[model samples]
Target: MRNLDLTTLRSFVAVAEQGGVTRAAAALNLTQSAVSMQLKRLEELLGQDLLDRSNRRIALTNSGELLLTYARRLVELNDEAVGRLTDDVYEGELILGAPYDVIYPVVPQVLKRFNALCPRVKVQLRSSTSLKLLESLRRGEVDLILTTEEAPGQGGETLTEMPLRWVGAQGGLSWKRKPLKLAFCNVCIFRAGVLRKLDDAGIEWEMAVDSDDDRSVEALISADLAVGALLEDSVPPQLEAIQSCGALPDLGIQKINMYGADSRKEVLGELADMLRQGFAASRGPVAVPKALTA
Candidate 1:
């Protein structure tokens, strides 16, 4: 009979999520050599190599990918169990606001880690456009918010910056349409800037989809009925970035900003830390978990 160790699994998951042993070690507050050894031990136990060391950056082998899916769940459950049993529990709801497109590649993972630490905290996620979310934050409707905009305005801090890309359904031809058919939700922060860029570049366009609902815009884009703007990493699996290739004008890099970071600082400490880690992870392609984009 054999058993898996939670400590080693934690190290493995950190390494996967952090994109390297060094970053993973920093995240876990463990020495680099210690994280490396745990990864080595896990590989020995599983009888398979988990990390591909061929490149400068670490990448998961197929076996590594398979193991990661289970590891995250196991570690999350373990933490939740411990936190629920040992910690002074906080029981309340947290109203969170975030733009729909920026939800991926960060928010979901942050929710998991936050939930584990504060098992009783019901994280109420409010998805809306950045400006609306900021308004919600100011109105005290949301506890904290994540926004994607050209830059953070007053009372907001930038988490990470990512280039906005022209996104469309796989092999979509909407970009080629004369008077380009654009699809974006009514209040999207990117919409106005995108339109300006198109006009400045002399690309004539019309709103093919202009519903206030995100799904309507996404549906039209995904069906190849129109094209839209999305963050570089948050683009859905069914979509691919349309190559500008001197055809479409480029949008500026957008910043993911956090609002109301100081409010309830003590209560949201764990969640804020997790969000920082999650956003930092988005900088590297290797750190992105499937759950993020999915």
Candidate 2:
């Protein structure tokens, strides 16, 4: 049986994502001709035309689109296997700051993958509000940080974007109250934006709880005392995303951005790449915390 080459597959995936062979070559650190040759070889081997070259910009053909899905997964799986098995070791410590809202379901995966790649590189994770994290980054107190913002800040690389959500008790009626009561961390990044959105909608709001502790806010929200805003996937177990269905104004989208790290360092660059992959990975469904129902 004929086999597809992983190297060529990676090039094809890059070209598809980067939008051209030259761009892919630069990204892969391979010559343009070399990337072109790999793409041709892959196409010949498959006996299918994968790219539509008739247009000014190359685009994926139906077959290429079909192949891209599998290619990404295969490439990711291969890289993961190598990272886990390789004995490559690097020693260093990097301080990483991120907001509490986005620490789960992505950061854990990134840390695990980074550990496999650089077992000796100590990464100290500090969780705070986004505004505070950005401040720490500016002060050089943290080597790198991730921020949640409506728009990415200067020198920031956005990893992913999700819609901001109004979250509250699963079966609560607080949303029905006028001058909607809100529970937010003292330095929560969403506070300003959410308030603006509410104001633009001509809705009045009152702060029901203001504490630096996330659990304190969550606890109050869980009791139907107040509501809060968060990114869609960041909503906690105790609080469910409010299906406002027009009852509440939309809080808009939030971007998860990386800032304050120079990619010149190999390990730091790898960590950023890992975060990119981690955020892109499939997150099937959010599970209900059993404790919530118990």
Candidate 3:
């Protein structure tokens, strides 16, 4: 029998987990035909059908089920080996992911310091919504993720909890309007908390702008289109805190977290500690910087 290739095994596993070629292809960023071809090659090498296509719904045959168990174990071991070997490279790459709103302002300085401390380590940074970052982490695409504690999805260790507050354009509208206009990211935890509090208080509110990027939200607020809730540290200087809005009902604070594969426990732990200390130092009560709290 020809030896099964890792690529083929990975494709097969993706299909099995996703339950369809189209979905697996999308998940793996491969064409459907390519995924099918890999599966065929894998079956040919193993000399047994891995999926029962006789039925409308795909099901693993007895032999296929057994092979899947071994395939998954092999893939996991392969990944672990790769991680270990790469760690030994000294010039190893660290893939880091985070939401832009939380990291954009501070990441450059953090990266510079990290590089100076571990000059041999190469870092690649990606910015996206917390949900997307967590998805990438689960798929083993990213080695580390830093996200708000209120992130909807699971997985990750809490590193720090940052305060969130309500803010708006200086001299903007009053809060008595029913359904206050609010600017926020559609999936933001801080936004969700704000909404929940409004609902509980029976205060109607409308989404002035549902955006994923902080820059867009900032623009809306700057234009005085609507008020916004943001991390205490993230509010830009042109805005003023609407303390009269009632403490944002204590959005319970948002925590920052770090996540990675199980094998990365040691390194992730170290990074998390460094991040916690940095955040604490940066958060001293300095009358919110003028740039952030005009």
Candidate 4:
């Protein structure tokens, strides 16, 4: 009988999530050569190659993808068991970062649940864009982050995915206006996708309002000051999805991700589980546009 080692599995998962052996080594506090050897050993044990080394960036083989799902769960369960056996009470400070606008309907409730589960654990939240949150994570400023990915499977572990659609005030013809007015955060990841889609479809647009404040952008959309692009599931009640906007291209699905720091695997894993459950439970009707589906 062959025994699968937890240490090797941890290295394999770190490589997959970090996107390279070098990054994984840094995160795992191991040498790059050691990390590579661990992966080789794991592959030999499984009798299959797990990674495609053809390109400069690492990508998972089909077998690799299949194992990743199980690997993550196994590692999580292993850590959870150890933590539960070692400590009945967990007390520590965790700094969490997230975009103010995207944290709703899920994050707040996740934090509430986390607090209840680990009453002595102190949590400090920092509101920032995904870009900034990732930087903070790297800088050791934030222990975990809930962030939005501009495209599906692009970055981070996706909690849920929703399409981006045009939105305008209910009963308003803002979408029909020429040089279609828009409002959004200047640093928003959706901004590039929104512009690229419009440009590719030969639709003219102008930025009418730009701010970091989500409420301001939503206000602009609500008052017919401009049309906006947002996740289908996140469209405001005062606004409606605009399906007939001329020649507008679909902004592909955006993923909400839960990213955690390299340390505190047990705590982060528990929080991640809670986040996934909370989002899964709260997910409402998806509002994909008809044309996009076609």
User: Whole-model lDDT, candidate 1?
Assistant: 0.81
Ranking by TM-score: 1, 2, 4, 3
Q: Pick the candidate with the highest TM-score.
A: 1
In candidate 4, how many clashes are counted?
Answer: 0
What is the clash count for each candidate, in the order shown? Answer: 0, 0, 6, 0
lDDT of 4 by residue, 1-294 (tens): 988899999888767755566656654657889989999999999999888777654578889889888898888777666655544667778888877757776678678657656666788989988878888877878888888886433336777777778888998788888998988888877888788888888889999985888788889999998988877766778998888745567777778887773355677776777776656544543222110100
Native-to-model Cα distance after best TM-score fit, residue 124 in candidate 2, in Å? 1.1
Query: Could you tell me which 10 consecutive residues in candidate 4 have the lowest summed lDDT?
Result: 285-294
TM-score of each: 0.80, 0.68, 0.59, 0.62
Ranking according to lDDT, highest score first: 1, 2, 4, 3
lDDT by candidate, in order shown? 0.81, 0.79, 0.68, 0.75
Q: How does model 2 score by TM-score?
A: 0.68
Model 1 vs. true fold: TM: 0.80
User: 41 in model 1: Cα distance from truth in Å?
Assistant: 8.1
> Model 4 misses residue 3 by how many Å?
42
**lDDT (Cα, 0-100) at 148 in candidate 2:** 92
lDDT tens per residue, model 1, 202-230:
88999997478988888899999889999
Candidate 2 on 205-270: residue-level lDDT in tens? Answer: 999975789889889999999999888877777889989888789777788899965656777887
